[model samples]
Target: MWSLPASFLLLLLLLLLGQAPPSRPQSLGTMKLRLVGPGSKPEEGRLEVLHQGQWGTVCDDDFALQEATVACRQLGFEAALTWAHSAKYGPGEGPIWLDNVRCAGTESSLDQCGSNGWGVSDCSHSEDVGVVCQPQRQRGYLSERVSNALGPQGRRLEEVRLKPILASAKRRSPVTEGAVEVKYEGHWRQVCDQGWTRNNSRVVCGMLGFPSEAPVDSHYYRKVWNSKMEDPKSRLKSLTKKNSFWIHRVNCLGTEPHMANCQVQVAPAQGKLRPACPGGMHTVVSCVAGPRFRPPKAKPGHKESRAEQEMKVRLRSGAQVGEGRVEVLMNRQWGTVCDHGWNLISASVVCRQLGFGSAREALFGAQLGQALGPIHLSEVRCRGYEQTLSECPSLEGSQNGCQHENDAAVRCNIPNMGFQNQVRLAGGRSPEEGVVEVQVEVNGVQRWGAVCSDHWGLNEAMVACRQLGLGFANHAIKDTWYWQGTPGAGEVVMSGVRCSGTEMALQQCQRHGPVHCSHGTGRFSAGVSCTDSAPDLVMNAQLVQETAYLEDRPLSQLYCAHEENCLSQSADHMNWPYGHRRLLRFSSQIHNLGRADFRPKTGRHSWIWHQCHRPRL
Candidate 1:
């Protein structure tokens, strides 16, 4: 062997010791940074930075929109619309590597901004930052003519804005519903309602961050406009009626990300002509606000304690409210728990902590989906009655033999429908099975009434079953006269209620709006019988051990072994049947595992008898 230099010998020694080469640290500098968390799109999530071959979150202490814009631009986005403090996307773990970051709004990357130095932070991970980047509008379909006509400022699709109209004292915060306005040709314009439909309303509502469209009361708009014109101090007559519209004749399927994505005949062509409406009506919309639009408030005079802050938890990637990958916030950082030793007892604690019911199913192996974070707890053990997951025993360490793919998840038992008074099943033995009733406002009072059975069937009954938290529809009654005479029986409130058996509630089903039925329409009142269990017959296991025994054939066929009268005095009168054959005989107890009660099909006096001998004493 040839003699080597000291540096070469040292490198060889490191390699033999299972250590990476000097180039390993260089690769960490080029590691990819990404946004990770629950979001409807890629541009929104908790702010996480990749450093030293690990991903970490930024502390939200003093995190501002300027810093958010810098982060978004680093990720190749235009700008940030909003920055969330207090971990709106939930906290993160691994390392809260940045804190008290201050950006000048034009920095190229987060690294260039002022911060408390790498891996140094006074704040906890509960304050991890989140950002929602402004969505990039589509300018693909515009022709050269249209593009040129729009000029530089309007080159992109016109923006949509909502102007608040404080019409009544009932209006409050979070500002859900507003007047629809579109920015066109560098100016805001109101939409004309010539051909406005509910689908069109939905697109506008979605743009305004609302969940769905509500029935717009057009009469209210008429009243407001008339009131304005009738104002004595108002400059109504002298002012021009030449208000221009940005776009009209909108045709949307109600799934567009923005109003610009909808089919609309846009500006310059319409701007040149005097503004006019075919229906002479301005578009007004009412939107049903979603959960996010509601602001959270702390309890009166009760600040959150340190213990309360330490025990926060959340669920992510679930289709509904109460099912998803379980994330626990520990020591200010959010991380997942491993599925090892995880069970319904552990999962139920998580569900209850999140304000949901017990766990419907405790899923293992990351069934909901793998999360991108550290597995903070492993081999979690919990009693079935723990209040929070913090009360459970767990092995603490990110390196515990668990991966993101092995993250635990839970499907929690959630309530059926949100609009409780809108639909209900009534007058049955159990709360789950009953006549269909809905609360409707008559005159100025709320009254519970029946649903029309005109188009009602098993499909519609399925919706009722789901709304009532019943398993499924066992039967749908076309006529409820049998239960109509009961107390609180009333008129029909809905007609032609049809469903596809997949709606979360009966209110989501199709109907001819809300209808009123006169009293005595018993034949058209809807009713439902729901079942909590499947139709199954189970033999009593304990009875089989004692009073019951197995019976085999030939002699088994000579008498009905299921009847108690078998092996009676009639056996001596019978001719010797085919030569005696080996047989097993036993008494059994059959239990019905179904929604309906158990009843014998035949009378006790009608039991069949045949030749069979009782065991001799």
Candidate 2:
């Protein structure tokens, strides 16, 4: 006779009593899909589906672009950029609902796609599929609205829980190093390390909010457990003695986010002659903690510094400037913030301080990689109008239960400034001024390459500046040889870019026919300096009237000014500045109010004099 585990039977009995385990809400004809985990957007995330009132995931087997298209369309996107396999976006919880899903690219909903029977999957959440949808093409805030409208609700996720024993002051946090455990039927049970792999360790680490996993000392844990099991006088009984066995023989692909997402094989009922860990012991894992937020600790009777009191903030370890893990200088030391309630509102404050527009994403779980030292804040509550993070309210004494693994991060929105990502500036002290670098894709790999300076002009530089989120091009330089150690020291793949000065990106400009350069290295590459503001050439009207008059000056004196094209034709071989009717003479001075020096394109000698309009009474 076939028999299922007692826990499985209990789950079924609960369902029959109309007490289904907690689940996300459901709507007719629409299955909820969301992109979660680090570095994700609304259009991309680990794929989970609502089946039989429970939120579950699909197996990556036979998952393809076609399957992704259905998911994207359902979420109001036009198409998908790509699909990911093996829980790339982090593992999902609940049952591995669907397996061997085969979509024909024309299915309106994933339920209509052919698949294996529901809840009968031979796969686990470690094989969970993910999709990256194409960016929204709709105008206004429709994309944001659609994403919110389709967000998951009533979500009850399973987690890889940890219990600490003999914690050390220096390396300990609430959810850091401890015995790895999972919950079943409302009781916690430890996993045996008999066949545990590093892949299993990776999943557990991610579930705890660490970006990646590190090597764990299983031997030390084994020795500790062996000592406890051998001690008869010890009051601590083995977990097997408690009749609690949640998971056994976990097998993972190293990318799952939670332990419930891993594959498990049940063991036979325990007996006096048999033990849960007959020859092995419970699994113990020590994950590298990310950044931590610690409360401000001041010396006895000392006050906080003015800078520290005012709540200054900064970002670090981002791919580009003005984006990364958020940190605040508190108590004269930089510390990280917790992600307990991190959202776009709190992220906006950090972005504004960094001179960016707003927060693009409020990344959590040490998304940008963990930072070192104490964490200073947690449960940050902001209304999106605060000037700084310190001004936001946080839960009192919330850092007690927070862990470094749950560090918060952010990606701020740089003002688009009519620019593209393919172009970048380097060599200057700031991001606004630097040698021009273009990203070139070769053999499916992107490499930053230099643009040949030959024929490079202001028009081309304008596009580069706007693309870099800088305001305007101040100087378009042909040779940056004077500047030391150019950025992107890569190969020169393009030359002679011709821009119309209104182009949004350098790629939109016309490329020169061939490459020619006396200096070949990127150090001598073309560069540009951009500024937020530009100077205007204003006419000094007051000075103009005071300097010159119709006094019939000598042609010799006027000849120099005339030769230089600084005067009207009345001084052209005339005996003197006389009998020049309707000719108004005045000296004009131009003052530049911009950041750079101003130079007139046309000489003064080319000036044409004309009579001013006046009303005759």
Top model number, TM-score: 2
lDDT tens per residue, model 2, 451-501: 888778887777787677676677888878666534445568677677766
lDDT by candidate, in order shown: 0.63, 0.63
Residue-level lDDT of model 1, residues 1-617, one tens digit each, is 88899999998998899763422112232334567775334467898887876799989887889999988766656789999888889889889877878888987667767676677777787888999886442322221212211322234454555555655512554344556677655776767677788878865664444545679677877787567767866553223254455566778666443455456764344335554554355577776654322333531121333323555777755534456778877766677888888876577677656545445456666655566546788888886446578778889746566887677887664432244446776666766666788776667788777788877898888667756656567788877766643456467667777786655556556776547444336655888887643333567655656764454445435544434544545555555554334454556666543323445557878665333434433
The Cα error of candidate 1 at residue 184, in Å, is: 4.9
Model 1 segments more than 4 A misplaced? 1-161, 184-187, 226-242, 267-271, 276-279, 291-617
Off by over 4 Å in 2: 1-30, 35-46, 50-54, 72-92, 106-127, 130-310, 353-355, 396-401, 421-617
Where's the lowest-lDDT run of ten residues in candidate 1?
140-149
- Per-model TM against the reference: 0.29, 0.37
After best superposition, candidate 1 residue 36: deviation in angstroms?
13
Model 1 RMSD to the real structure?
22.3
Model 1 residue 53 CA deviation (Å) reads: 32
